[model samples]
Target: MSVRLRLAALGVAAATAAAGLALVTAPAAVALDNGLARTPQMGFNNWNATHCSGDFNETMVKGIADLFVSSGLKAAGYQYVNLDDCWALPARDAGGNLVPDPVRFPDGIKAVADYVHAKGLKFGLYSSAGTKTCNTAGFPGGLGHEKQDAALWASWGVDYLKYDNCNNQGVDAVQRYTAMRDALAATGRPILYSLCEWGQNQPWNWATSVGNSWRTTGDINDTYAKMLSIFKANIKLGQYAGPGHWNDPDMLEVGNGGMTDTEYRSHFSLWSIMASPLLIGSDIRKATPATMAILTNKDVIAVDQDPLGVQGTELSNANGLHVISKPLAGGDRAVALFNENGTPATISTTAAAVGLPKALGYQLNDLWSHKTTETAGKISATVPAHGTAMFRVHAGGAWWSNPPAVHTSADLPLPYPGAPALVQPGTTTTLTTTTTNDGVLPGLLGEVKLTGPAGWTVKATSPTFHPVLPAGRDVSTKWSVSTPADTPPGSYPLHVSTTYYPGKSTSDYDLTVSVAAPLTAGTTGLGDDPWLSADNGYGPVERNTSNGESKAGDGHPITLGGVTYAKGLGVNAPSTITYYPAGHCSAVTATVGLDDEKTGAGSVTFEIWADGNKVADTGLIKRGDPAQSLHADVTGAGLLRLIVTDGGDGNTNDHADWANAQITC
Candidate 1:
């Protein structure tokens, strides 16, 4: 059988097992009937901004609860306040019951839940299905104490539970989560169960009956790339969502400072269209006016809360231009046009192409601008870079109806070569672009021009030419591009435009030239390596800092002999980095270290391989350890590999760095 089929079968088997577990006491019935969250749940979760910080306490939760009522959020449809990880004490009490941290929550969790309930909002708490939570404090989890914990939470009037996945002792996901589901049902309380497994086990396949909502991706940071990736991944999983269950792409980072206001609107619109649970990850107390406007838009929220409960589908996605259409109740549709590219372009489409009937006209209303227009055939707009235009289309057309003028007779195709072109610093490269006339018309003439960054020099060979570009004909142009010696490593935008004769029709093509850092011989810093890639890893390599481990003194420099190396690569746990020699190199040597300058608390085993063969292995470096020197013979070898792994213990502060790496021919 195919892998996908096998996975689906496993999901069905897991669901059957969960049903069997639920039927142990009584006949098998439907999953917990929590009348809450009939639509995607709207709430506030604390993790993105304040991660395991000591400030997450009773006072803070009450303050946020007060803000929800005073700031009009409760009336605007947000009703839950969730306290993420680190809410409990490090150990259980003498009676083996989970205890709230006295210092953080002096009034106890029951009092806090009462405060939220008094405000007409629900209370939620965080816990893992394993032996320990994700926090470094090692708080008690709900692995063996599911029945006691569920009963305790139900007694405390808990309305929601965010069950995380950490330290799960190799137990199957279905069994662990099903045990919790059965336990929660036994309590007979209507609590929303959210499975925060980070989408590792494709929870959507089996989590429909197991959880009210399941995270479809890993945690999201406040960046355009991260938000866009989550949206793209969640839009394809619509088949598994319904009224009681939803696909969660983690919390919303809309009001965060990493992205601009325009980008945030696109983020909100896409999330609403995908029918994702809109869990606000920002501090609502200090939300700016612009942020408030985007969050409280009634038109967008209505589409998300529509009774249909059908998630949106992608209509067209090409060249960073996307169109997502969500079917709403009352025969209306919510559409979003997204420009994920860095450069502006004119994107056009028709309503019929987006699953709307072409013969029947519709009225388009822009959700952000609150403007309405009538169209019969096509709608076109010039979208800004990294922005979106959202609209709601009704089935009937009205006054001031004007469709885009249809163009026939001629078509122009402008295609650029080597998209996202890569080059080394201080190097010269050649860029070729082609323009063609794929139409029946005879007379077509145009000129192509290239524009790039300020410090770089770009000159085209032809620059100015009036060619007799006819039907099904093409022409190519070349440009000599060069960057300065001190050019920084980043993606630089390059715009190419063509203007034709007669109609003076213009077309644009956007290109990004990536300048890579150069790696040479003699004392090359590992962090400064030109090419760095990771498998089963995240984020970029850092200079003098650990990537995932945020412990103090874990980001200090590495010292060997008299030279102190401050730049290197830091990984989470089991990750490998393969280095490709820039030029001809026979051997490479480096000093590897664990943790920071002061001391190393975690152990990491380092291995070096050359051309698929193991060259060296440093057994295991323990805490408070110095640097270890290792060398690998790379004679005629195309690649050199460096592997670091957690040494028996869990991946806490497993920071491994290679210092003062160099290549010798």
Candidate 2:
């Protein structure tokens, strides 16, 4: 006895727009306020688990809905039971209304919606924003019939909509998606609108006011590279996300079999920190124990559902190791350390480097291992290959007092002017940081300890300067810092700490040193520009390196002075590079090119501004085009700025490079 025949037959009423029904369009200045999904939406979708199999019938949906209640998933905040593609009839009925497949959905969509509602769960339906869905299933997409479809779904009590992109006939994405948004608003129903356009149109820039959650990348497979690539792309778009608007990096592939458990943990942890929607794409009816454990971990989920709604940012991606940090609502922070290398390695970072206050100690709670420990600013974890170590850090207490006010400043012999002191790899540089005591009583200046990145030798030359510092007195210490010859180009943290009496209070001074790649002759106009190697809001400028064709910035190759030189500054579109002369250079010039070796289907517009004035503007440069030469007379200019934007098509492969760049003093 098949469950389809045993269920009572049901009919769906045709839905039509009323006469003189004013179409409620999305507000230009704000997003649709459905008052739902204020945080990332949690639920179950059947795409990764069961993609359009014949068993995707009303009975299976009902079974999943029942499990949602019985298996305690609802209690854990998993609500929506979404049906992906293939639940609809091949074509519309006589009245041009969408029809569910008779054999699969014997009781119609409204009945399923009602049943899901009866269990206190929401019902979600999937449709293509294009002419047809990804598969040739019965689903007739809502391309030309957005109004009709929105009305029907609203009438059927649908609570959520996962609108995908497939077979869109060269139509503009913003227009089609905005049409659906306006149509859904016209229905006067509070449906959660999800934009699934595969992140093709840079929806993070335009879709905030249109949908609740917009996918920021293409579909994610259950592989390590696919999952990691999606995570990297989404993390960079954090500035565009907030409450009511989110950057969706596709659904969760945590329970899928393509990756190991360690890699899956990394996937889930990164996604949680990024505040992406935690829609599980696994079969909930028979979830494995490990999958269920990862999914139901409330501590990890709390990070995603944090009330602050701020997305995390990548702190570092050097040497195949990555660190990400997110600020929580209660002044706590979430940090994730990912080891992308093939071999297991020990990685460490300081709380100050992740934007925590330097003077305060922190209590760290491992979100995955559930271990708790307290640290005096330094945190270290040995992670497995392709694994992640995540922690929630709470401010424990202040280690230093107000009486012993310590003022610190760094002095480098050959300063790069306005930028931080530069330390070339394989060279010893003496870093002198002076600490001044402005307290009421004398204090002892104890030993100074310096901690930096791995493979770097940082020793305090004046370790035991037990000088009695009277009130209003100051003392200086020097550290001999040396980097390995093969250190990657980035800003590495150089943390300086020491304990002094009367109370033996710990004083900490945090600073950064720029490590530049050995530049070749004739590569730049200036011998070694400090601003070119340091991180200035945008990530550290990599010399002569291609961000590579694989979107994840893997296997980067070197570029030199030629038009096809292996390295320069590589950036996606909508990025800015500002260089402060720091009184070091008077004029700057560079050859900007769209990398012919790495870029595909990328177009960019480059602009140069000197002292707030537009100096040069390259209208548009497409892939394989000749490089654009530009020069700027930056005499007496306080700042020089370079802006790169997508050539009116959204940033897909907008890999831009700066070649033969130089500055003249």
- The residue pairs that clash in candidate 2, if any, are 525-662, 544-567, 544-568, 545-567, 558-566, 559-565, 559-566, 559-567, 560-565, 560-566
| TM-score computed on alpha carbons, candidate 2 | 0.58
Q: Model 2: per-residue lDDT, tens digit, 90-205?
A: 88899988998889899999999999999999999999988788886536888999999999999999999999998889888877888898899999999999999888777766
Query: TM-score for all predictions?
Result: 0.65, 0.58
RMSD, every candidate, angstroms? 10.0, 13.8
Residue 242 Cα positional deviation in candidate 2, in Å, after optimal superposition: 0.7
Top TM-score hit: 1
lDDT of 1 at 514: 57
Name the regions of candidate 1 deviating beyond 4 angstroms.
1-32, 399-665
Name the runs in model 2 displaced over 4 angstroms.
Answer: 1-29, 397-665
Q: Rate the local accuracy (lDDT) of all candidates.
A: 0.70, 0.71
